[model samples]
Target: MCLIFRIILTAWLISSSSLSMALSIDSLRGVEKRKPNVIIIMSDDQGWGDLSMNGNPNLQTPHIDRIAKNGARFSHFYVSPVCSPTRAELLTGRYHPRAGVYSTSEGGERINLDETTMADVFKEAGYATAAFGKWHNGMQYPYHPNARGFDEFYGFCSGHWGNYFNSLLEHNGQIVQGNGFIIDDLTDKALEFIDNNQNDPFFLYLPYNTPHSPMQVPDKEWASFKDKSLIKLADARTGEEDVVFTRAALALCENIDWNVGRIQNQLKKLKLDRETIVIYLSDNGPNSSRWNGGMKGKKGSTDEGGVKSPFVIQWPGTISSGLEIDQVSGAVDLLPTLADLSGINYSIPKALDGISLKPLLVESNQKWPDRMLFSHWNGKVSVRKGRYVLDDNSKLFDLTTDPEQRVDITSQKPELTKALSMAVVDWKAEVLKDIAIDNRPFPVGHPDYKYTQLPARDAVAHGTIKRSNKYPNSSYFTNWTKNGDYISWNVDVLSEGDYAVAVYYVCPADEIGSTMQLSFEADKLDFKIAKANASGMINQQYDRVERMESYEKDFKPLKAGVIHLKKGAGELILRTTALSKTNALDFRMMMLTRESP
Candidate 1:
């Protein structure tokens, strides 16, 4: 076994007592059939009530619903309120904060390298592992899917993408051109992986980056939902009247369902449906203004609607048809659960905020006790225990009686509130013990990522963030807004090597003489660029599009000289000392390329 796998297994064996009853390694070795192929399909922003099976009146996700109908459904499933945290929790089998992820951008999205992932366990057990679609965990090496454990990876690394049609994507470690709508293309690629690896046990994690934002869809998919009055019930519940946003949002959801249907059909055609364990769930709740099964808050909030998600586990023989498991669970449970199901003796070494749900899935009579489940975003914190929920605001809700959280019951349940509050406090403390993990550097000289592009989202801006486009994914730095302003990327020099740096920015005609200095350690390189038109430079050079609207941004470039020395970690900063005009520059990316050792 590999050293890491041995460490994970040895650590797990020492910690777990009841895993033998769940499924031991010796028992898995003696099984008659080859280990079942695992396919995990996770949508980006789907919610509990976004499906017809879960009582969403607006849309019917028949393909997604079939997985729930034929297998086990988690009625009280929970996850982090945002994309990156839930993914970190799912992959590491620990709390997001504990696993070195607390936010979507600015270096907070990277997963820690030491934590063993579900795919890592499966890969050690001889499964052909792959990850498709959205990889929001991290962009650079050691955290990328290929380095994390997957043998194959094809996806984008950002929290959300700008385009859906014919986008440039990463295949393994190389950039490749995509052919169809991103969702359809991802499904096709996943199907192809299955076709090639059918002889061996395979684990495919398909986290689609669609139905989240940009509101772009094929003409046919949008046509299906635009004219129909689909959201009267949803509107009454959400109290949203923007018809255009509603139509576009519904269109994205239905299109995702269509892609799901395509994958299900492929499995059936390949005759692999019976021998595979398929899971369908979402990273978090809905991003748009829509119905969320009457839960309290939307995405990014520490409430039921933000954290609740639909979880379905479908296996032909073992899991019964239409079984609803009401045990409270979090995304952290997924890693240990999948490892247990696969019969791999691997466990995470740190805080195991999530436990294995193997017994609960196998036996309906298994009594899994309820524990405190904490949700966090910025300064908000929420604790959920069975039907009761307590937030950072000191508001309490008995969800069994007050599902909408309309009334606060702190006065009635003083003792219970205090206990839950204390649990949340303790959990947060344990998770945040290593607060430096959130701002740790992504390695610069790794082979998987020879050139590191530090976008505006990942860089630290000393001034207030002002974007040409106010969308969350837009790139910019209005340097003139503040005196002595600068931006930098937190990065480690993974290896000593020769390098080149490319800076992406914008400068008006009058600001042609603006000078930028790229500094790291004791070395510095200066640059001065021309007054060329900055119109649509991002799309021209890198094919980046406006995330939400028609606005297209451009950037000027500078060839900053590079040097080599001892290997270590530090910040890569770009500072401007002089500008002919008020604003020195607006930046999109700063790329560092290693030439040689």
Candidate 2:
């Protein structure tokens, strides 16, 4: 069946199911009002305890807290253990693994094209859709936000950016420079989008990347927590908390709160506050072992702390203010909940993994079903069902009495333990069947998109050339000391065309003379690095705390002419034919702009 017909069928079927909520609309003299606008603001690496409202005394997040005070707060909410999966879940209303999101960077981060996103649903329902800030789901066309039902997208597509201030970013499919700090710049663009679409129903997704490392926050924000004393630290049992890093993270969260306030102010200024639904949430747990309400595990673990997130929603004159829901929700529920609450009919193209939270929010006395929610990452799976948790190792714990998973109650609840264990095995067998191995190649030169970007994060370095850091996102290929050293990417050109290639790189004044060649199949293009661009790292100068990811440099893009490539799959390789000094250049990215047909 066609996509449109399938969605129509699903909508019809789902409307009759118990998951559907009554369409909410205001009528004046029998004239129907416009649909409610949606603005979902998500933070990166900000944990449940990062907010002052969440009982953290280190920093303040009044703007984020206001969402809870004005509307509803979910006390027990869950998300993926990492960024990309949570993003996939939010977009599709399905489990991340079902959508082929197994990793945070490169090809694995791309959601399968077959999966329909919430943007698709909203756009199809005649709502204007745009996404601002970090788009970790995918970077290329088709998988890119532009093809994923978002009319406009402005941000970096990588998992995490290296620099946050006046850094390189993208608008739609074109590369551009950001205005100031990334979070602020993204908010500015979102405000512009809202201004343009004030009269229309719109879905705005502002996914902020912050507090996630490179530890860069504005000086104003950094000043507040630079030397502030902390009363709460990461659990003493873990013993891995760094005070400086914690301070930096708290400062970043405060900055995010400021941006959140800006967004709220914009809506209020436009008089759309009561007409729009605003939500605030974090993608995962804390990036570091900071104070997180004494919950176990950090970002990568599938425990309560790692997967738990603070979920706050504000819909003035609609959702009751200060309504604290003790029900367990997850990132997967956002799409359906928003669609149902807004009266927009959309059906999951595949089997839906999330149910609408409309009953819990709108119908307080409704008989909410007791369902199990699963959190999986890096081969660890944990199931949460009504205050009880079955951890990855088949150990059970009642969260009401043991929130830290300290005492395994398997002996006390043998039957429940066995049933949950078998459920995990069945769930794994079903969700992980297709993703056991990834043989897909990165795509290039789609007919619909004019430009294709292949950054160092997606490339493989050969010989003595090594990546600047262990984390691939926003990293560069350096130490290119040998002639045979090269960087390559497995790519499939979707269209045959002549593409104008540009290489973003940096070379010292002494090591400026090197001939670099890029080849795919039998086609080749050569460029000489005759000029020097000695741009040093920028992170150390701006970072309030030490960073683990590679610092970014202002690499100049060298236009290396054009090469005609046929439609096919092959290794796109970059190597030096002749080196002048000890190194060739610090390679950052390659851009391919397809010439007009």
Q: Compute each candidate's TM-score over C-alphas.
A: 0.83, 0.94
Residues 1-597 of candidate 2 have per-residue lDDT tens digits of: 699999998988887663333322223234566899999999998888899998998888899999999999998899999999999999998899999999998788989989999999999999999999999998878889999999999998999899998888989878788898889899999999999999999999999999788798788887888889999999875568899899999988988999899989999999999999999999999999889989888898888889999999989988999999988889999999999999987766597888899888877578877888999897889998888989888999899988877898999999999999998999999998887688878889999999899999999999999999999999999888888689999999999989999888999899999998899999998889998889988746669777888889997888888998989999999998898899999999989999956
In angstroms, the error of model 2 at 554 is 0.8
Least accurate 10 contiguous residues by lDDT in model 1: 537-546
The sequence of per-residue lDDT tens digits that candidate 1 reaches over residues 1-597 is 699999999889866756675567658676566788899989888767778887766776898899988889988888888899999888888777777786676667888778878888889888999999888887777777888889988887777776577765768655567777889899999989999988888999999986777677678776677677755344354456455665666677788888888878888998988888899888887776676666777777778888888899998888888888866888888887877777777645666778888898787567777677788877578888888889778789988787677889999999998998888788778767675545467677785556665667677677653555554344466645444567777778787777787676666666667677777788677776555445443233222222353233545456766756347888877777565567777776666677886
RMSD of each: 10.0, 9.3
Which runs of model 1 end up more than 4 angstroms from their true locations? Answer: 1-32, 234-241, 407-415, 433-439, 447-451, 461-474, 477-487, 500-566, 574-587
> Highest TM-score, which number?
2
| lDDT (Cα atoms) of all candidates against the true structure | 0.75, 0.90
Q: Show the colliding residue pairs in model 2.
A: none
Q: Model 2's lDDT to the true fold?
A: 0.90
